[model samples]
Target: MHNNLHKTKENTSLTTDSEWAITHNNLTSVYRLMGDLSNALSHLQIALEIRKKVLQANHSIVDVSFNNVGIIYHSKGDHKTARINYQEALEIHRKSLSTVHPRSAETYNNIVFVYDLMSDYSNAVSYYQKTLKIQKKSSLSLIHPDLATTNRNMGCTYAALGDYLTILEFFEKGFNIRKTPLPSAHPDFAKTYKNIGSLFNKKK
Candidate 1:
């Protein structure tokens, strides 16, 4: 992934356009997926700097940049940085988009996810409920990807709380929603199933 990014720098003449932006973004994502977080952040920082300069700061690309960086922090288990980045993205969405915009819901869900990972289940539920509120009001369907994410996060919270029944319930709800809207064998659903099995195994 870093190798690909170095290739991107090779095309200096192609610099600064949205096309270049996408290459850099892809490079950033690939590095993160490959677990090279430092490399990911370096390219992401460069891409984000370019994004801020090339596109309007409030453009959706800015949101994407913020989101990508936040996700890296989340994956790295840096809850404080994840929380701050999510709030930053949320602020950008709120300022640039409509009240019930999908992007705003996405940001809310993103923050909620980090809260769950941080073991702050109460705040996690608070934000998921907030996302649910906005999702219900939107013209979008109840089964939107972000909505499902919120539900899955709720399930994960229940799992963390050691309430297996509720965990199963929310996980099933989330899984059912995603089954049609997303791929059948999605990793999130796989996670829920794994959690269920792990809980039962421990009890035995």
Candidate 2:
């Protein structure tokens, strides 16, 4: 992917506008998955630039580019920059998509994650609730993976706030969802158990 993307860059005159953005975005994802956030950010920035040039300012693809950049910044622990990028993405998503769209919900979840990392539990809960509202109104099932993730994130936020009862409720909801669909050996399934155990230990 790296070599292909670099070759595409070298032959920029041969690449179409959409092709350039797509290749850069794909490279960004590859780098991000490898935890090379610096390269991920660089590629995403290039994608964003290319998209901004070829696509409208409020294009959905532009929103995705911004969101990808936010994810990289969030993973790098630059919560401020992550929040800014997420807000940018959210604004574009809200303008271009329905309120209950999956992308909007995902952006809200991303914002919630940043708030959680910043130790801003109140804001985290607020954004998590937004994500939940959207997910519930959408076609997603109660046991959908995204729903489970939001529930678990809410659990973590409540745990941080010392609301053990609410934490347990949310965690149990998420755990039940994962347990029904995921194999016992799945990492997510194991994580649910671990989270429950940790919360129980905290209570004790």
Candidate 3:
């Protein structure tokens, strides 16, 4: 698909820069999903450069590119670079979107992950709180997957800080949310139980 999209460029009348940018972005997603981080980053950068040339700096698409790049960096364990890209994405989202918007929440969540990876428990918790606030205001159900994931992540962070009681609280919150929507045999539900058991073992 990537090559086919490029081939369309041969007939300039048949393709626009925006089309090329979208194709590159799609390719980036495909590569990222395949765990080809290098290719994903390359395609994402191409898309970002193209969009920057053709669109406004604060365009939502531009913000998406920045956020996607940040996610790649985060996955690569380059927490500093990831945080920088996330901050840029957050700034753009804040300027163009409501505080309670899902995109903003996503950026907040990304930042939380970065901070967690960096072992900055305080910062991680702070961003997690921001993410929760946005999710709540957006009126997402308690059992929403993102909310459950966030709760789980917060529990892990608390566990890392040796806050056993707090960890249990967040872990139970996540488990309860998952238990209703997820079947008993689902991996997510089982994982939640596993996490709770691990916390107990740690406490012992």
Best-fitting candidate, scored by lDDT: 2
Q: Which lDDT tens digits does candidate 3 get at residues 132-183? A: 8899889798779888888889999988889999998988888888889866
- Supply every candidate's count of residue pairs whose N, Cα or C atoms clash at under 3 angstroms: 0, 0, 0
RMSD of each: 5.6, 3.9, 3.4
Which model is ahead, 1 or 2, in terms of lDDT? 2
TM-score, structure 1 vs. true: 0.67
Expressed as tens digits, the lDDT of each residue in 1-204 for candidate 2 is 568757867777735488877877787778878888898899889889988988999998899888888888888889999999999998998788988999888888889878887899999999999999999999998779888988998998999999999999999888888788877888997788788899999989
Number of the top TM-score candidate: 3
Which stretches of candidate 2 lie above 4 Å from their native place?
1-16, 26-36, 175-197
Q: How does each model score on lDDT?
A: 0.77, 0.87, 0.86
Misplaced by over 4 Å in model 1 are 1-20, 142-204
Q: Which residue pairs in candidate 3 collide?
A: none
**TM-score of each prediction:** 0.67, 0.77, 0.80
Models sorted by lDDT, best on top: 2, 3, 1
